[model samples]
Target chain A: MSMRALTGLKPIPPSEITPREVFLDRRRFLAGATAAAAGLGTAAPALAEEMAMKLPAARNAAFSTTDAPTAKKIITGYNNFYEFGMGKSDPAASASKMSVRPWTIEIGGAVEKPRTIGIEEVMRLPLEERVYRFRCVEAWSMVAPWIGVEFNKLAALVGPTSKAKYVRFTSVVQPSVMSGVRAEVIDFPYVEGLRIDEAMHPLTILAVGLYGETLPNQNGAPVRVIVPWKYGFKSAKSIVRIDFVEDQPRSTWMKLQPSEYGFYSNVNPAVDHPRWSQARERRLPDFFASTPTLPFNGYADQVASLYAGMDLKKFF
Target chain B: MRSARAADGRFAWATSDPVRALKPLVFLLCLAPALLLVHDVLYDPEALGANPAETIEHVTGDRSMQFLLGTLAITPLRRITGWGKLIRFRRMLGLFAFFYGVLHLAAYIAFDHYFDVPAILADIVKRPFVTVGFAALVLMTPLAVTSTAGWIRRLGAQNWSRLHKAVYAIAVLGVLHYWWLVKRDLTWPMIYGAILAVLLGWRVWNETLGRQRRRPARVRARAEPGPAE
Candidate 1:
């Protein structure tokens, strides 16, 4: 939050590119109610496909990881979208009412030319599959192949002014659909933020699909950012607003418990979450396995230099 | 109250103590949740969902708190219904609470940490939530050990009764353990706490206001030694 210049270069692609069998064999897994999904189950295939976007993109080498992807069911079924409800399965069970169609994301704040981008146009932006290690602050993690356009590609569409030092993301709160919205779980519309450099980093992407299918309603449906280095909550879901701002935005978790959740919610083993240790994470399927959590979730080579001069210990 | 209980006793099959007839049913009912968890673990793994270990911990912990509260509820319920024989189930309910609590602790130790002593000790020490949870279980140990009729007879009913009152403190600690550990949304924990408060509030009311209402009843209550507490 203090003085630090972005100096990290893109990490060299590890020899272990995204495994083919990991994604290929997983096609048999059930796809949730998504119009864009290949096996569109419901009577109205055209309507569903219209609402969802199909990705023909191959798994990109650079963003790929060697880790096996969390089964699509677990990735789709077990979600932390508080809008649906607090339980892990609540999102999958309760998100059916959410209408992802007729969605438009408003981009504004300190940008040179602010404009609204529809879900269709947004999803069409050169999609690619990137497997990332998704770690939760609650000390569980999963690996998943996400299909989406890079954040920089989307950010390039809207020219940012010098005043745009930070990026604020806001998720839509539909009280009619989302029961958690009515429950008022830590403010209805979940808010998150990113430093301008972090936002522009190549590792960052706006994910729209998982396991080669359209994003499930529970899995942020139309759009969500995937910042592999940060905690999963930092990848705000059901996003409707992206504001380029002057100051760092107060994320929902940060607002709820500032001491526990920081603006830079980087996955750091040394900085333990007040309630639980961030040192080890339970990888899904291998639920009891104690896998040591890496700094920046093993993306330190690409992102650590961004925090070069600043003391990560600072309340800043 | 004695007259009501005596009158109710006439309908033994209808009310209980013929509680022997109901005991096995209640036992099976209590064992049901644990059985389902076993079934899920052994045959249908995914039934517990993505994190079965966490689910087991939650279910066992939840049932433990529920039975602990249920054990507390018996006295008030019996008093309200004028069914003295309802006292027979208290031991079973209490022991079940202890049983499920053991299961809860076992899941945490075996599944969560795989019996890592240093890690667990560090958790109990460093985390206030874990510490409170561990303390609640520790306090329950003596109560659980001394729950038998033989032990109650050895300890004397009055002393046994006084010792078992620690359940109230255990209840508080259990609720505090729950309240402290929740990531967000105090709804479930608050509901459990509310139930605990009501159970605790009933005793406080009986001790204070009920004492004035039935001054002579105090002598009668003292004259007759209650069941194995």
Candidate 2:
């Protein structure tokens, strides 16, 4: 109890009037960001189970976007999950080939208590729906209500040692099912990383589902990172390993093209991909129209301080 | 009488009746892709998926390349099938390539850059992918314009053959444009490249050793030398 308060991860009473779940929920995030009767013992394989079991999460409007959410059909059908295939619709079509059951994320490296956490155990932490503006590096945007726990709460289980400077996230490489993995499009076991501060940011979450349902196979079922302020690739999908490390890890995109993709790929319109302008993005369903892209993907007030004094152009 | 009838059967389709019958079908086949694309934009846009602008760009661009390749294919296919009049549809195929290439360009200009001239120009100059794609379209214009019988008469058949040979270069440029733009998977572009390679390689081989190859001596003389290509 003292250690949780010492680390500043202790859950305080919600708005000075504790919700029943807030006081009872030991794993509730700090700052009272979300409260829910987080459940456990809901077994895996969302694909096999037909997603009949709903993991009800509170719609935390505090973290939600005022903008309308993209339709679930479009969200599920249109994707950039290169693991399944390169085409936009390939993921949704072929992701059913892989099963999302018996999944476990290994937590280790530069942490005091390293342990393997199952999907069910990870979902035991309070769940909440956050409608976030998801900006992809390919210059597309979507507002999705993602359900998950704040990453800091998950990290709170084993406090990082003083040596930890960065966090590396690695996605599962299902070569047997993933067409890209079999073809070796870039590399398997896609890796992404974040600075210690960015990983611990309140906005960073490990999303398990979206739109009041367990994530479809296409959307990286079981668990995936949702870093709203950064480019979508910065949020690794189907994450298998979370390693708190001393040195910054080279992400898959960064390894593929260092000049184009940097470690801190925050959504900045000013910094453009050499091939195209990032100044504006074409929102889905509106083919010819484009809207001006906001700096830090409109989360500057929440995340801009993370990059203070650092030249974004250089890092980007 | 039986031998004469067999000979007539061989050359009959190459002449008016079947060629005339097939022209409209091929023409419709060529126009179908564009019509479907426009229909999707106007009516059933969901068929184009989430990124319809990008989808439009890809559909128009891919169809352009397909038509360009089909145009190139006419010569080799005519030679192989000994179909003398197959060459008549070459102009139509080339024109369709240009038409779709124009649509592809319009998609990029209207959707991608939103008619921002400076941005479009800057992108065309700065990115090698855009540069090659634009060059392919620019090079295709002269061939499409000179495809008429009047222009053929004005330029002479020999000179027109030399000018139209630029189709090979345009094909290469089209393939390179696709190759350079893809982020990771080179599978489709590589397939296109292989087809282009085979076509170009066959041309090189034909130029080097085609005189000895079996071509039905009558068709050989009628086809003339490389100058009439």
Candidate 3:
């Protein structure tokens, strides 16, 4: 195989790929039958089950990267959904109470066509799997296979007026349901925003599913934005509203600590966080080794032009 | 067995042999956390989850704080229970606190920064949390070194006692370091703060009462000057 193939840059055609059912069956056979046949090995079946879930290859060749996706367990289990709690593992345990069904998102503010769209209608929009690298501001990263539509499609539907320079997202804020709200850890109804061009960027997506299944609540169920070039918090989860505005919107983290979390939180290795250096990130499930972080989280080739003249250090 | 009497004429455990007998058990108890971490590193690294280095660092740091608080509680506990023997374990507990604190600092230097002194120094200078934590560790070094009987004798009881009062400042810095380190949740730090408040409050109460009791004697001494003056 070529280096590109080994690096996962080359896209395999759909027909050449193994079917999901066949793959799962092989996994089950290896887990159940092979383990028993191999004289009752203790760890084999458990390890196989732990590594069972795998998302289908990205259909959009443009979005596919040379990075392997993080383990499904790590992607689902380790999360930073502050609406549930502050601890990374708290969300997976506490987010089960969240009800995403019958959800509707209201899009308004400087948009010519203001309207409310149901979750079902949004889900029906053409979905494509995009494997993208996710970089968190806390110096951790993961490669996630997100299944969703481009934010441009959503923007096109909303019909933003010329005055709309930024797109703001708001998360669901039912304090009765979300226990983390009681603590007031952050301003409730967690808000995040993106520049109009950044929102319409081809790479920006509103993800509904991951790992070939409906998104787990801990991993932001229903719908959430995914901006590959920005910090993970910029991808607000369980979105309830999207508004187009002229002024730069205040993000939750930026509101809490303006110095630490800037509005344009693009992943820049050179701009170190006030607390620690961002030169390297600890890739999940591999705790011992930390890989050097890349500028724009290794997505600079596609998005670097957006900030051609501006200074990233000042903006960051 | 001969029994020692407290100032109030109460029998104290310091004269009993059981206090010395329990020293080994207390020593093992102090060593338990480090042993558990070593075992996890060797046999089941996954027990610490995906970030074992972080886990180790957090555990050691937390243990150091707990032991520091435990050391502070010895006086109050000994006074309340009339267990003079408790004072014997105070040095051991204090040494354990210093031991865990050093380990915590070692984990940050070795694992987190990979011994990159420049980067570590930069963090210490820039980050308030790291700054206070580093200061607390530095303050603890002298206390730990001068804890020996020889050093205490050389310094004299009054000077030794005055110098070791720095532990109170160390505890405050330690709590502040923890409080500043957390981004959102202040639950653990708040609990530590409450404990530190009570411990310090107890000392203040005792000192005030001591001053009140001594004031009358001081006034009488001034009123009736003796020939020695």
The regions of model 1 sitting more than 4 angstroms off are: A1-53, B1-17, B215-229
Score residue A261 of candidate 1 by CA lDDT.
88
Tens digits of per-residue lDDT, candidate 3, B1-229, equal: 2335544565554544666667768889999999999999889987876567778889999999999999999998876566788998999889998999999999888777767789789989999899999999999999999999999999999999999999999999999999998877899999999999999998887688756765565466457867986
True contacts kept of 2: 0.63
Total backbone collisions, model 1: 1
Q: In model 3, what are the clashing residue pairs, if there are any?
A: none
* Best-to-worst lDDT order: 3, 1, 2
Clash pairs of candidate 2? none
TM-score on B-chain, cand. 2: 0.85
Chain A superposition TM-score per model: 0.83, 0.84, 0.82
Alpha carbon deviation, residue B200, candidate 3 (Å):
1.7
lDDT of 3 by residue, A69-115 (tens): 98887788788998888887788776765666557999999998999
TM-scores of the candidates in the order shown: 0.85, 0.85, 0.82
Give the clashing residue pairs of candidate 1, or none.
A35-A48
Q: What does candidate 1's lDDT look like per residue over A229-269, in tens digits?
A: 99999999888999999998999988898888899989998
For every prediction, compared with the true complex, DockQ reads 0.44, 0.50, 0.34
